[model samples]
Target chain A: MEPLLKVENIEKTYDGKKVLNGISFEMEKGNTKVIIGPSGTGKSTLLRCVNRLSEPEMGKVILDGQVVLDKTVEKEPRIDLNAIRSQVGMVFQNFNLFTHLSVLGNVTLGLTQVKGMKRKDAVERAMIEIDRVGLADKKDAYPALLSGGQQQRVSIARALAMDPKVILFDEPTSALDPELIGEVLQVMIKLAKEGMTMLCVTHEIGFARSVADEIIFLDEGKVLAHEPPEQLFSNNSSARIRTFLKKISELYGGE
Target chain B: METSSGLMIIWESWPMFLSGTITAVQLCILFLGVGVVVAVPVSLSQIYGGKSLKFSASVFEQVFRGLPALVLLFLFYFGLAELDVSPLVAATLAMGLRSAAYQSQIFRGAILSIDSGQMVAARSIGMSRIRAIKCVILPQAIRLAIPPWSNEFANMIKDTSYVFVVGIIELMRQGRYVVAGSFGNALLVYSVIALIYLFLTYCGLFLMGRLSKKLAIPGFASAGAAMERI
Candidate 1:
């Protein structure tokens, strides 16, 4: 079978500086890929480029055998970004919940507005997702009233409600407090156990080690190593990778 | 003249003042109703439209906000008189047009105040930009705009008095008529009219305040009000 999401030779720039230089990756169905890197290493940019949020200067992004983005084409394939995005869910670092809406409203907005599902059906599906994230009781509450973890969970439910083929998580737990990170990680681990296709950018080495099928260590817009957790963490032969791992362990220990 | 005659003059002139109040209120509503309608597009264009559209919106804002309301009233009333535009229509257009410029700025500020992430989150779910604006952004922006937008109501109501220059018999014009007709009892007549003006302004503010309170977001209180509590 074709890879679920394939990103080819993605390059991006800010001003005259290259941010993502010739980055490429592919994920098979049900595979969970975690991207780990220090700040400003184009990890987030790589994820954004997949969805054309930060348009790549040169790239081809294919999702489930469909060409979602082809930056090489002058007039490109007239694809609707909204239609493409509807199938690709993105969970942000800030939660980015619609503050004006209730938990249930936030989860169901895309379903009702984008998918044109009936109100009753959307509510039912949203309820299931909200319940799955353990936020069933807080459906009527607004984002302001919820804790950081709860709000992030709601955002996750919002993305899941779209029934996306693959979910892109951009540091989903980086914004949460230390005590609150476990609940979000637990939810994600459960998704992984159920074989959800996920592309996550995070520094939580503990969650990553336990959950990632393969971890891609990115540096300066290039993938330094792409290997399973045991090989990269247990027996990393490269001094640069070892030094980076040591610094990350010292700062945010592998809990 | 005895105080009794002064009271009698006001009592007799009550109908005139009442009619004047109605016209003033009518004009105020029309100007602001149309002002808000015009402001949405103007503000959206300034913030989201292309270069020429943004420039046009900015030019409109600058020209109208810089010119005095009285000047605009005169230009529309007398300048367009040859075209058979009535004083009322000219006054409405002039004041409404200028109010739209001010209101557009007010709304643009409110729109910008919304988090940029709101649009991203909305679009990530497949919403078109316009749909995101209508559903996710504007609801919050309009709620946030209430306190600032209310000032426009008060400003336009007072500005409606300028229409008297073109001979529309609104509140201020009726007050003048009352004083002149009552043999220069300017003190008593003007006092009653002032009280009436005060009453109308207070009522408008009361209603708007109630509306603002009703629509305010739970945590996102108006910055000025929140600052006061702190």
Candidate 2:
């Protein structure tokens, strides 16, 4: 099958400094790809570029089959940004839950506002995702009242409620307390097992070891290593990969 | 003797004082209503609108906020008299426009103070810019704006007396008439008028407090009233 999401030669810059230097990757349907690297390796930028949230200076991002951003086409390419974003959900480092909205409202906002679903129908649809994230009982609670772990789950449910084809997790659990990280990781693990297509930028080595079909190791805006967990973890793997893995494992112990 | 007679005159002029106070209160309400109507777009333009829109809003802020309310009232009432402006319209436009400038700044500050994360989250869910602002940004920004907005309300009340120059017969104008008729009662009438202004300010602040408490989200009470429990 054609890859569900294809990112090719994406070059981005910030303040005259290259952030993403010619990065390329692809993901088949139901594949969970984890990108790991030290801070500022352009992992988060890569995910943001997919949805055109952060415009790239050069690249072609194809989602399912359509081009979302092709900077080379013209001086300025004007794609349907909101439409592309609707199909590719993103969970941020910060939970970024709408402070004013309740959990149910957060989940249903996209449905009712963008998809034009009736209020009653949107509530019905959002409830499924809320239950999936185990926040069904707290649906009426506002984002401000929830704990970091609970808030991240609600954010996940919010993205899932959009019925997106693929979801991007940008350091989803990085902001959670060490003990709270497990709840969010478990949710992601379950999603991976249930065959959800995800591109996650995370530091959790245990999660990458368990569920990542391919771990893409990025550094200085380039993919240094991209392979299955077993191959990447094997002794014959590059010392660079081993060193990085050792460091991450030390910071975040294996599951 | 003068003090006793001053009280007697003030008592007799209750009807005039009441009418004048009512007009002054009405002016403050209209000032806020018009201020918000203009401020919302002006403030949003500076932040989200294009280069030219930002420039235009900036010019408005400079022109209105730079000038004194007294100067604005004079310019509108006397300078624009050929355009057929009434005293009430003059005062409303003068103070309302000025109030808009200040309120816009308050709103912009509140909107900016809200982490940009809010906008990112809204857009990630596929909400258009306007929808995101309406549903996400403004809800929190408006709550944050309340504390500073109360300041604007209090300021506008005292400035309503500036309309007395154009002869609107509001609180200050009524006080002037009482002093002219009673002679030597200026101190008594003006003192009572000050007390009345203080009462109006108190009421306005109380209302703002209630509004802030009602709108505050559970964990993020950035600029809502301090009297949340009460």
DockQ of each: 0.74, 0.75
Q: Tell me the lDDT of model 2 at A150.
A: 98
Tell how far residue A216 is off in model 1, in angstroms.
1.2
RMSD of each: 1.7, 2.5
Per-residue lDDT tens digits for candidate 2, residues A37-149, read: 88888999999998988988898888988879787676656678888899988899999988888999899999999889999999999999999999899999988788999
Instruction: Give lDDT per model, in order.
Output: 0.89, 0.90
The regions of model 1 sitting more than 4 angstroms off are B222-230
Per-residue error at B6 for model 2, in Å?
2.5
iRMS (Å) per candidate: 1.0, 1.1
Off by over 4 Å in 2: A75-78, B222-230
Q: Give the per-residue lDDT of model 1 (tens digit) for A129-148.
A: 99999999999998877899
Q: What level of docking quality does candidate 1 show?
A: medium
lDDT (Cα, tens digit) per residue for candidate 1, span B106-170: 89988888888899999888899999999998988888788888888888777888889999999
Which tens-of-lDDT digit does each residue in B126-213 have in candidate 2? 8899999998899888988888889999998888888889878899988888888787578899998999999999998999899988
